[model samples]
Target chain A: MDEQTALGLIGDRLAAAGDDCAVVDGQVITTDMLHERTDFPAGTTRYTAGWRAVGASLSDVAAMGATATAAVAVYAAPEFDGTELGAFLDGATAVCDAVGAEYVGGDLDGHDEFTVATTALGETDDPVRRSGAEPGDALCVTGSLGRTAAAIRLFDRGDIEAANELFRFTPRVAAGRALSPYASAMLDSSDGLARSVHQLVGASDCGAALTGPLPIDERVDEVAEDDADRRELGVFFGEDFELVCAIPEAELGPARDVTHCRLHRVGTVTESGVTHDGDPLPDRGYSH
Target chain B: MDEQTALGLIGDRLAAAGDDCAVVDGQVITTDMLHERTDFPAGTTRYTAGWRAVGASLSDVAAMGATATAAVAVYAAPEFDGTELGAFLDGATAVCDAVGAEYVGGDLDGHDEFTVATTALGETDDPVRRSGAEPGDALCVTGSLGRTAAAIRLFDRGDIEAANELFRFTPRVAAGRALSPYASAMLDSSDGLARSVHQLVGASDCGAALTGPLPIDERVDEVAEDDADRRELGVFFGEDFELVCAIPEAELGPARDVTHCRLHRVGTVTESGVTHDGDPLPDRGYSH
Candidate 1:
C-alpha cells in the first residue's frame, strides 16, 4: 500500500500487537508494562521523536495479533529545547488515529536524553500462540521480503523512488486476518526470512526450503544483475510487517488477487527439524 | 498506611505508584506510554534503584480507578549486570501482583543507567474522574502523606526507618473502588496534598480547603519536630498514592470497611476557590 494508507491504518485504530492503545468493542484498552520488560530484543534504540517512539511500541502490539485500545505515554520531553514537541505529538496522534486507537491520558517529564515508556492493553483472547503448527502444513508468506532490506540500502544511498516503494509498508492486517483463520501457526516477519523460518521450525517442529529465488523487487534485480547474491533477501535486515502462515497443502487456495505480491511454497513441515536438501541447518535464526 | 502494608500489598508485586507492572485483576500491564506518563519527585537524579523507578508509573494507573493487565517494560538494567534476570523480574513482578496485575508480555533494551517504564490498565463504569467534584462536598483523603518526603530526607541521613516508611506506598485501589460509588470527584496525591487539592478543584470547577494536617507517620513527626522549617504536613516532595475524593457528607456510612487505608476528613469543598488562612494562593499547589 501507499504511505498514507500505512500511516492511517496504523495511526488510529490498531487492532493490536504494539503501540500505546488498541481499541476493543466500545471501551478502550491499554497498559503500562513497558518500563522494565527488557530481556528481549536488547539494544533496540529508543528514538527521540516522541510520538514516533510511541508508534514503535504500539506497532509491536499490532504485530502480536491483538487490538490496542488506550495508552499512557510517559515521555521525557526535555525543557527549553525547541525540538518540536508539537511535531512529536502530531506524529504520535497520527499513528494512534491511523490504528483507530485513542489518546486516553498520560504524563510528561523533563530529562537529559529522550526516553519514552508506553503501556497498551488490547481486547481479551488466548493470544494466538507461536507453537501451534503441525506436520504436513504448507509454508507461506504474506508479502514479498527483499524489498524492505533493499529499501534500507537504497534510502541510505538516496534512491528515493525505490526506497519509497519498498520502505513505505502497510501492515498486512487483511492478509494476516485472512490467513490467521486458516493457518495452524503464524508469525510476523520483523526479522528476515531465514531467521523466521528457523523460528517456525523451533516452535512447530519443522524446516523450510527455497523452492525459488525470493520474491525480490524488480528494481533490486535490475541493479544487482546476475549477482546471484540472495543473501540480502534471506537473512540480512529487519522491519517488514509481513505474515508467515503454516497451512495444510491441500487446503491452500488457488491463484487470487493477493498475487500482486508473491507467495512461495518454500518448504515442508518436518518432524526431524530444519534442513535444506539433506543437510542440517546451523543458525537458529535472526539475532534480534 | 504502614510501610510493610504498602510493600505487602504490592508484595513482590512492584505495583507501587512507580513500579514495573501495575496489578489489575491479577494481571500485569505495561506499555511504552509509561516512558512519557511518569514523573520523578525530585529533578534529575540517575535512577539507581530499578524497583522504585518502575513503581512510579504502574501506581499511577492503579490510582486512576483501574487494574494492571499485562505490561511491556523497557529499560537499561545496569543494576543487573551480573544478576539473573529472574531477581529483577521478581522485584518487578511482585509489584505487578501487589495491585492484582501480572506481566503478560514486554520488550527489553540495555543502557548505561538503570531505567524502567511500566504501563497499566484497569476497569470501571467509567473512571472516577477528578472533574466530578461539586460545591459543599466533603473533602476526604485516604491514607497518609508527608512520609515520602520524610523518607527522602532519611535516605540522605542513612536512616533506614524513614526510608522504609517513605518509599513503600500502596495505590488506593480498594479506597478508589469503594469511593467510586459515592465520589463526586477523585484524584491520587502523587504530586502532593496541596497540589492534588488544587488539581481536583481546578478540574471540577470548585475549591477545597485542607483544614487539618495529613496523617503522617509518628516517626515522621518525630523527625519533623527536630527541624522546625520541615514541619509543613504536605506542600512539596512527591510520591504519595493516596486518593483525594470528594463525596457527599450524607453518604459516608455506606463506605465502611471497603477502604484499604485511613479515610481522613481533611476539609470541605468551596464554591468560590481554595485558600489557606488569608492566602489568596501561590502554586497551582505544586509544580515540577
Candidate 2:
C-alpha cells in the first residue's frame, strides 16, 4: 500500500499523528526518515545528507511553533567511513545549532543501504495546529518556494555546487514561534504549496481562494526554463520547509515584524475547496 | 566504521545517550531501527517484524524506569503488499497496547529494502541511569536470559513456531518503574548480559566480578547440547530485552518485592574487570 493508504489504516489511533508535531504535555515530538537512494542524489555528500535529514524533522517541530530543544537519530548503513560519519555528525550538529537544538546521541546499525531516522523534541506553551483556521482568515506563507526544485534540476544536470547550496535549508523555528500567538492554523510546506493548502483545508474543514501571485524564489528564475516553469515549480514542487498559516488580516503586520521574514499574502480561507487563478488547484504533490 | 566506532564518535554529546533512554525534563525518549537482513531471518512474518521493531524501542524506555506514553515509526520498503503492511501495523499496534503506549503515527517511504525505525516517548520522575552505580552495589538482572539465542538456533533449525514464540518478549515497564526508586544504575541487555555488564561498568566508572551461575532460561536446556553451549548463548547472544541493574546489597529484597520478577544476584560491582567461575569473562557480545 502507499503511504496515504497505510496512514488511513492507522486512522486516528493517535490524535497527534495528523499534526506537524505531536505535543504531549508541552513537549513537541516530530520524526522524519531519509533513505540514501531516494532522498539523496549521487553527488550528495554524507554531510549534506545528515544536515537535510535532521532539518526535515526539525521543520516539523517548527510547524508547531515549538522551540527546538533536542534530537536523536537512528543511522543505518552497511558500513560507514570514519571520516564520512564524522562529517555527517558535524552536519547534523550544525543544523541543530542553527535552530537552537542539541544534536543528542543516536543509535547506529548495519544495513545494506544508508538510512537515517531523526526525531526532534521541542517545547511550547501555546502551539499551533492546522485545524483551527476559520473562514475569512487570511492565508499567509513565510519565505519563498521553488529553491529545492531548482536545486534538484541543477543536481540532475551535474551542477553539484549550486545544487548543494540550494538544497540546504533553514528550518523556520524562530518565525514559527513568532507567528504562533496570532496564527489560527499553521503547517510547513514540505509537500509543495498546492498540497500544503489542501492539507490545511482538510484539517481546518475550510477552503482557500489562492488569488494572489505565487511566491516564486529568485533562484527559480535563474534555474527554471521560463515563466510557466517557474510558476509550476513554485506551486507544485515540494521541500519548501516554509510555514504556511491562516491568520486574521490585522495580524499580518505583526507577523512580518516579529519574524523579520517576508510574509506573503497568498489567499483567504473560504467555506470549502481550494482554487488558484480561478481554477481548482490539484491535490497532488511529492510523496516519499 | 562499525556501529561501535560510530557511537564512539558520538561520544558525550548528551549525558543520556549511553543510557537506555534519554530523559529530558521528566520526558523519556528512545529510538531503535531494524533492518530486514540483519534483524530477521527468512520466513519471518511482517507482524513479527513490526512487533519486534516497536518492542525494541519500548524496551529502552522500560530500562530507564519510565512509563511508556507513545511511539512513532519510520517504515521504509521498496514496495509493500497491502496485506503485509496491514499486518505490520497490526503488530505494531499490538505491541504498543501491550506496553500501554499509543502507536501515534509514523512516516512511510520507499527504499531499496525494508527497514523500520521506532521511537518511544515516556515519562518518569525518578528515572534510572547507568552512571549511578557505585562500588559495593549488588549487580542484578530481571527475568531469565538466552531465549533470543535459543530462538535463533530454533529458526536456523527450521522450527519456526518455536522460534517465533521464543523471540517475542514483554517489556518490563511496570517492573522498571517499581525498581526506579531503588536502582543505582540500570540498562537493558539488548546486547547480551556480558556486554551489558561491561557497559554498565564503563559508564559507572567501576567494574563487576560476576561470581554466580549464568541465568540460563529453561528453554536453553531444551534447545542446547551442553552446559558450555548454554553459558555461551546466555553470555554471547543478545536482544534479550531484559533490564540489568545495580542496587545496594541491603535493598535487594525490596527490589525483588517491587519488581516481582526473578531477581538474579549475578555479581557485585568492583573497582575494575568482570570475571566468572574464577576466570576473566571476555568483553565480547553482539554488535550492530
Candidate 3:
C-alpha cells in the first residue's frame, strides 16, 4: 500500500537473533529503507553531508528511544581524494559526537558518486516503537515541521534563515526521551505529516482525523517565496526527523508541557478509516 | 604505509566502549572500512551489476573470521519499476543466504542513477584480525585468486564463458570458521595478495616473505583465453572473497589439512619487511 507497508511485506521474510551488536541488538533499531540510504546533497553543505549521513541512522535509533553508543558510517564515491574525503569524514564524525555516538569501524570504497550510510548502535531496555498508539489517544508532536523543507527550498538561493534553522535540524532527543515514558506509537516525521499519519493509522490498523491547526512556525513563512511555499513546507516536504508521539487524552496541552520541541494535537486515531474533519484522508503520505 | 596503518591514523581519534554490545553487543571483530555512500544507475540487472552492488560489502564481512549476521542495502535511481527494484533485493537476499546473514532493513530513493551500497553486520566472539600474526608464522591461503580479475577482463570484452565461477564467487565462510582457532591474521584476498600480505605485516608490525608458488587452480585454464592469462589472473584483480590466514609454523600444514578449500602455504611472516624470498615486495595490486 505504501513504502512501510511494502517494506512490512519484506520485513516479514527476514528475521535475525533478538540480540545484535549494531542493528539486531535490542539497544539499537535498524533499517535499510529507501530514505535511510539516500543522501540529500543539500545536507552536504549547511550541516555537511557527513553528519546528516550519521544522523540518518542515529535518528532511527533515537526514534526507538535508544541512546546511540557507537556507529559505523560507510561512504562511497567514484574518486574522492584526501581533502574531499576528509570533509565527508569530518561531517560524519561531528554528527556522531553531537548525538553522543562514536565512530568505531566501517569500510570505504570509491564508487560512482557519494552515498554514505550508517549503522548506529545505542543502549536502552525500553524502545519506543510506532505501533503502540490506541484509537482514543491524544496526538502529540515533539517539534516543528516545515523547517528542513524550507531549508531545502532556500538552500541553493543562499537564504541564511532557512539554512540556519532547517539544514542544521536536530532530532529532539530530550523531548523524545521525556515523551517516551508517556507517549505511544512514536514515528519520525521524515516523510511529512500526511505520510506519517498514514503510518500511524496503518501500523495500528486504525485511522486518524486532523482537527486542530498544524504547527507551521513563523520561520516557515519568513522563508516562504509564496503561500504555497509555506503549505509545501508544512505538508509535503520531508527530512524533519521530529517525533510524533501519541499521548493519553488527559495530558493534552503539549506546548505547555513540552520544552525542547513544540507539540500540537493535530489529530486523533479512529476505529474506522481515517478522515480530516469528517472527510476521508489519503491512505498514505510517504511521497516519492 | 599500508591501508591498516592509514586506518590506525584515523582510528586513533575514534572513541569506543568495551561492552560486548559496545557497537552491537558481542561483536568480537568488525570490518576494515566502509565505502562512502554510492549512487547507482536505475534498473540494473539481477545477475549482473546488482549482485556486485551487494557483493562488495558482504565480502568485507567475510574478510574477518566473523560471519555476516545482517545487511542493510539501499538504492537511489530514477523511475525504476517495482520488479527491477525487486531484482536488486533478490541479489542482496542471495548474498545473505550465501553468507548466513539476513537482509534486515535499508533505504530507497529516486535519483539520477541506480546506486546501491550495503553495510553488513557480522559476529564472532574471537575474530581473526590483521595484528595477530607473528614472525615465523606461516602465511596460508584458501581458494585460488585472479579468476575474478580474469572474469572482468573477459566480461568487459563480451567474451562470456558458459559459467563465470569467479563473477558469481561465494565467500569462504565454512573454511574461515573452521580455521578460526588457528588463524592469526585473517582476511580475504580482496584488494589482492600483494596488498593483503602487506596489510598483514603493516598492522602486525612484522615482515612477511612470499616464498611458495601461487595456487593456480584448474578453473583458471577453463576461464583463460591465452597463456598470458596466468599473469592477468595473478596480478591486478578484485573480488576474490577467499581467506588468507596465517598460522604458527607448527600448525601450518595441519591447519591446511582440514578444509575443502584450496589451502596453500604461500609465505612466512618475517622481521625484515614483506618480501618475495629476501627481496622486499611492493604493496600495489588491485586498485579498486
Candidate 4:
C-alpha cells in the first residue's frame, strides 16, 4: 500500500489526498516530512534541508492562493548539533520571511535518524481546491520544470554547488495570490508535471491535452546526459514546486496580466481522456 | 545542545520553547513526533501509537486551554501495512471526535523506520499562556500523575493489557476550556511534575512549593518493587498528560466548580525557589 491507499481508510470526510494543502475552517494547512536519507542529497546542508523542508510545505500554501501565516516543525535526531540546528532555523526563518510567513515555533525530539516535519498555515477568504476544472479551461503552469531533476543529476555527479543553487526554488506566493481569483482548479507540481496533470484530471473529473513543445528547463539541456530526455525528465522526475492551474479562457488574460510569474499556457482541460502530443499520456510520474 | 538550546537560537520572537503549544494570532499549534523504537514499547499496538501521537499533541492544546479545531499527521515508515495504518487512523479519528475536533487530513511518506508526527490546531478567545502565574497562586493539576510511568513498568513486565489500558490518556479538552478563564499559568505535565513546575516557574518568573505527598499513581504502588518510590516516579518519570496550572487561591474553588475534571491543589506558586516537603526540588525530568 502507498500513502493514498493508507489515507483512503480515513473515508470520504477528508478532502482528497493529493491537494497542496487541507482547508480547515478557512485556514490552509499543509505538512511535509523530510527524511535525511531520502530527501537530503549527500552534500545537502542543514540550512538547505530546513529551507527546502519548510519551503516545500509553503509551496502548498502558495498553491492554495492563501496569505501565509505561521509554520511549526517537528525535529527528530538522536544527537543534537547546536550550530547545525541554528543554521536550520536560520534557513527556515529566511524562507518564511521570503514568503511573507512566520516561523512561529516547533517541537523537537530524539530519534536514531534526522527527520523534519513542517506544517504551514495560511488564511484565505475563498480557499481554492483542486476539483473545479471546466472543460475548456486553460491548463497553465507557474514556472519552468526539470530544474530539480537536473539538480539531482548534478548532485549525483558531485556538482554540489550547482546542484544546491539549482535546487533552491522560489515559491510563487505572489502569483498564487494573483491567480486565486481566477483559477478554476489548481495544484503545485511537487510530484512532477505528469503526475500533477494526472492528479488534477482525476480530482476535477476532467482531462488535459497538451499542445506543442513542453517547457523543458534550460539547465536540463546543458547538464543532462544523452539518456535523459529533457521532456521526460520534466514530466517524470518531479519536485517542481510550480503551481499547475486550470483557469477559464476568459480569466486567463486577467491572470496573465496581474501576475509577474512566468506563465506557460500548457494545454486545455477536456471532458474526457488526457493526452500529450496527440497521444495518450503515459501513466507515470514521481511518487515520493 | 538540546532542543531547548537549539530553539533558543530562534530567539525571543517565538513564544518560549517549553510551552505545550505555541500561540499565534489566537491559534494554538503544536507538534509531536513519535519514533517507533523509543516511543512504542514491545507489544504496543498501532492503534495505541496513533492515538497516543495525536493525543499527545492534543494534550498540548488542552494545556493551552484552547478549543481544538483540527489535527494533521505526517506518517513515515519503511512499508505500509493496511491494517496497522487503518487502526492508526481509527485511533486518531476517535480522539478528534471525542474532543470535538476534526481529523483534517495529513501527509504520508516512506522512511527507514516508523515515525509519526502530529500537529493539532486550536482556537481560543482567551488563549492561556505559560507566563501568567503570580506569586501566591495555587499550583494545581488536572487528573492524577505517574500513569505513564506506571504503564511503562507494566509494559516492561510484559503486562501488555494493563499497559495499554494505562496508556490511553484523556486530554482535558473541556476542562481546559473551563480553566482558561481562571488559569494564571498552565501547561501539561508531560515532562513530569517536577519538570513542569520548574518550567512554569521559569516561564512565569515565579517558584513553587509542594505541600505534601505527590499525586502518585495507585498502580505504581501495586506493580512497583520495594525500591520504587511512587512520589519520585510521579514527580520525575513524566508522560502524565494532565494539565498543571496555577490559579489564584480565590479562583481555585470557582475553577474546580466550572470543570468536571478532577482538580488537585498540590502546592502554591512562590516568589523564589521550588521545593517538595520543605526541601529543594531536583531540576530533572524527561527531555523528549
Candidate 5:
C-alpha cells in the first residue's frame, strides 16, 4: 500500500486522521517520520536532520493556525555518538526555540539506519480548515519556493554548509496564526506549491487560477539549468514548509498586514478546474 | 553515547525532559521508539507489534496519572503490506479503545526495517510524578509481573497465539488515575519492578524494602527452569506495563477501593537503601 491508500484505510477507522494535525480538545497534534534514506541527504549533519525532521511536524501544527507549545522526537540509530547526539538535541532545541515552542526530551533506540519521528503539540480555539475556501477567495503563499530544491543541488555540489543552512527553513507558525482569523482555508506547502493548491482546492470543492508569477526563490537561479527547471523547482519541488492560504479578497490586506513573513498573491479560487497561465495544473509533488 | 548519557544531555537543555511524560498547562505528552530487531520476535504479528509499541507510550501517560486523549504513530517499513498495515491499525485502534483514548492516526514511510515511533497525549490537573514518594510510604504494584517474560519464552516455544495474547497486557491508565489523588509518586513498570522501585526511590530521595511475596504470574511456571528463574523473570524482566506506586499508609485503603486492577502492597519506603526480603535488590532490568 502507498501513503494515500494507507491514509484512506486510517481515515475509514479514524474520523480525525486526514487533516494536517489531529486536533483534540482544542490542541493540535501532529507526527512525522523521516528516515535516513528518504530525508537526510548525503552531506547532511545530525543537527540539520534534527531541525528538518522536527520542523516538519511543527509546520503541521502551524497549518492548523495554532500556537505551538512543545515537541518531542524519537531518535533511532545503529549507535549513538555523544557529539552527534548532543548536536541533534541542540538542533531540535534551536528549531523549537526559533518557533517559540519547547523541545521536551524524547526516547532513543538502536536501529540499522538513523531515523527520527517527531510530534508537535499546539493550542488553538479556532482552527482554519482546508475545506473553507470560497469561489472568490484570493490564494496566497508565504515565503519564496525552491529553497529545498536549491539545497539539494548545493549538497550535490559539495556545498554542505549552505545546503544545511537552506534546509533550516522557518516553519510558518506565525504566518498561519496571523491568517487564521481572516483566511478561509490554510495549509503548509510542504508537498510543493502545485500539490498544495490542488489539495486546498479539492478540499474546498473549488478550483483555482494562478494568474500571478510564481515567487521563485533567488537561490533557484544558482542551481537551475534554465527557466523551465526553475519553474519546476518552484512549483514541484517541496519541503519549503511555507503556508499556502485562501483569504477573501477583502480580507487579504489585513492578513498581509498581520503576517510578518513575505506574502504573495499567487492566484484566485475559481468555480471549477485548476489552471495556471491558462494551462492545466497537474496534481503532483513530493511523496513520503 | 548510551540512552542514559543522551538523556542527561537532553536534560541539560530541556528542563522538562526527564519526566515520564512532559506536562504543560495541565496536559501530558510522551513519545516512544521501538524497532523490529529489538522489539518484535519471529512469528510476532504486525498487530501485536502495533499494540505493544503504541501501548508503551500510553503506559507513560498512565504513569503521569493523566487521562489519555489521543495517540499518533509513525510507521516505517521496507514495504507497506496491505494486510500487515491493516492489522497494525486494527491493533492500535483496539488498544486505544481499551483505554478510552483515540488512535487518531499516523504517518507512513519506507525504511529498511519495520519500525514504529508513537506519541500519546493526555490531560490531568494534578499530574503524578516520580519525585513525591516519602519515607514510610507504601510501595504498591498493580497487576502481576512476568507476563512479557513468559510470552517471550512461549514465543520461543512456538506458541504464537498464546504469546501474542500475553503480549497484549492492558495499560493501567484507570488505576493510575484512581491513585493520583492519594499516591505520593507513580510510574509504569515498563523497566521492570526493580528498576521502577529504584527510580521512584531515587527520585523521591528515599529507599524501599519489599517484604511481600513477588506477584509472579502463574504462566511463568510453564517456562521457568526453577524457582530462582521464576523469581528472576518476575523481578528483573520488564515490559509488564503495570504500575508501581508509593502511597501513604492511610490512603492505601481508599486507593485499593477505587482501582479496579489487582493492587498489592509490596513494600514500604525507607530513609535509605533498597532491599527485598532482607536481601539487596540490585538496580537492573530491561534497558531499552
Candidate 6:
C-alpha cells in the first residue's frame, strides 16, 4: 500500500488517530519512528539521532498545545556500545530537560540496523486541533525555516559539529502553549511550510494565501545556489520543528506578545485555493 | 554495553525509568520494539506479528495493573502489501477489542526488514510494581504456561495455523486488575516463569521456592519428549503472556475469587534463594 492509502485506511478505522497527537482524558500522546538510513546522515552522531528522533514526537505534542510531561523510546541496534548508548541517553535527556520534561527509560532490542521509536506524553485541558481555522485567520509560523536543509549541506561538507548543532533545533512547546488561547488552528512545520499550510487548510476546510517573504534561515544562503534555491529550501525542505498556526487577526498581537519565539505572520487563511504572491503554491514537502 | 549494564545506567539516570510501565499522574505507559530477524520466524504471518507486537506492550500495562486505554504501533516494512497491511491492522484492532481498548492509528515507514515499535497507554489509581513483593507472599500464575513453547514446536513442524493461534495469547489485563488490590508485586510471564520469579524477587529483595508442580499447558505434552521436557518448557520457554504475581497469603483467596482466569498457586516468596523441589533453579530465560 502507498503511504496515502495506508493513512486513509488508518483514518477510517481510528477516529482519534489522524491528529498530530491523540488526546485522551486531557492527556496528549504522540509517537514517531526513525531509522538509520532515512533519518541519520552518514556523519550524524548517535546523540543527534536520539535528540532529533524523540524531538519529532515532542513536536507533535507541542502542536496540540500541551505541557510535555515525559517521553520514552525503544532503541534497537545491531550491538550496544557503552559510549554510544550513554551519549544517546544523554542527548535524549538533554532534549527533555530543554523543555522541562523527563526522559523516562524504555525498552532495548537488537536489530540489523539502528532504529528508534519514540512516544511523548503531555497534559492539557484544551488541545488545539488542525480543524479549527477560520477563513479570515492569519497564518503564522514560529522561528526561521531551512535549518535541516542547512544541516544537510554542512553534513555533506563534513562539518559534523555545525550540522549537529543545526540538527538540534528546539521543539516549539512553549510557543504552542502561548498561542493555545488565541490560535484558531495549529500544527508543527516538520512537514515543511507548504505542506503544513496545505494540511492545516485541508483539515480546516479552508485555503491560504502567502503574501510575505518566506522565513528562510540566514544560514541557508551559505549553501544555496541562488535566491530560488534558498526559497525552495525554506518552503519545501522540512525538519525545522517550528509551529505553523492560524490566529484571528484581532488576536495576533496578543499572541505575538506572549510567544517566546519569533512569530511571523506570513499569510492569511482563505476560503479557497492556496497561493503565494498570486501564484498557486505546490503542496509538496518532506514525507515518510 | 551489555543489557544489564545498560539497564543499570538507565536506572541511575531516570528515577521513573525502570518499571514495566512509567506512571505519570494516574496514567501508565510502556513501549516495545520487535524486528523481523529476531521476533518473526519464517512462517509467521503479519496478522500474528501485529497481535504479538502490540500485545507485548499491552501486557506491560497489565503488569502495572492498569486499565489499558489505547495502543499505537509504528509499522515498518521493505514494502507494504495491501492485503498484509490490512491483515496487520485487523489483528491489532482485534487484540485491542479483546482487551476493551482502542488500537489508535500509528506511523508508517519503510525499512530493509519488517519492524514494529508499539506503545500502550492505561489508567489506574493504584498501580502495581515489581518492587512491592515481600517475603511470605504467595507466588501465583494466571492461566497455563508453555503455550509459546508448544507453538514454536508446531511452527517447526509447519503447523502454521496452530502456531499463529498460539501466538495470539491474551494480554491478561483483566486478571492483572483483579489481582491489583491483593498482588504485592506483579508482572507478565513474557520472560519465562523462572526468569520472571527471579526478577520479582530481585526487585523486591526476596526469594522464591516452588513447592507445587509447574502449570505446564496440556498442549506441551504434544511436543515434549518426557515429563522433564514438559517441565522445562513450562519453566524456561517464555512468551506465555500470563500474569505471575506475588500476593500476601491472606489475600490470595480474595484475589482468586475476583480473577476471571484460572489461578494456580505455584510457589512462595522466601527470605533468600530461588529453589524448585529442593534444587536451586537457574536464573536464565529469554533475553532481548
Best by DockQ: 5
Q: Write the per-residue lDDT of candidate 4 for residues A16-116, one digit (tens) a residue.
A: 34578888778888888988777788887777777888888899999998989988887778877877877777778788888898887787888887899
Write the number of the candidate with greater lDDT, choosing between 2 and 5.
Answer: 5
Model 3 agreement with the true structure over A1-288: per-residue lDDT tens digits: 444544554455444311112346554545332232343534345236666656666776777666777677555555545565566566667777777767664555555556555566666777777777888987766667786666665665666544644555554555656676677777777777777777766667777777756787666787787986676777657677777767768756553465455777788877757676676656444454
Question: lDDT tens digits, residues B223-259, model 1?
Answer: 5755433545445454566777788878766654566
**Which has the better lDDT: candidate 1, or candidate 6?**
6
Q: Which runs of model 2 end up more than 4 angstroms from their true locations? A: B13-16
Q: Which stretches of candidate 5 lie over 4 Å from their true place?
A: none
Write out the backbone clash pairs for model 6.
none
The superposed Cα distance between candidate 1 and the true structure at residue A225, in angstroms, equals 12
Per-model fnat list? 0.11, 0.67, 0.35, 0.67, 0.80, 0.69
RMSD, one per candidate, in order? 9.6, 2.0, 4.7, 1.8, 1.6, 1.6
Ranking of candidates on DockQ, top first: 5, 6, 2, 4, 3, 1
Lowest summed lDDT over 10 consecutive residues: which window, candidate 6 chain A? A3-12
lDDT of each: 0.51, 0.85, 0.62, 0.84, 0.90, 0.89
Which pairs of residues clash in candidate 5, taking residues 3 or more apart in a chain or in different chains?
none
> Between candidates 1 and 3, which one is better according to DockQ?
3
At residue B158, candidate 6 shows an lDDT of 98
Give the per-residue Cα lDDT of candidate 5 at B183. Answer: 90
True contacts kept of 2: 0.67
Superior by DockQ: candidate 1 or candidate 2: 2
Per-residue CA lDDT of model 5 for B27-108, tens digit only, reads 8899998887878888889899889888999999999999999999988888888899989998898899989999988888
Every model's DockQ: 0.16, 0.63, 0.32, 0.63, 0.76, 0.74
In terms of lDDT, which candidate is strongest? 5
* Candidate 2: residue A130 Cα off by (Å): 2.0
Regions more than 4 Å wrong, model 4: A11-18, B11-18
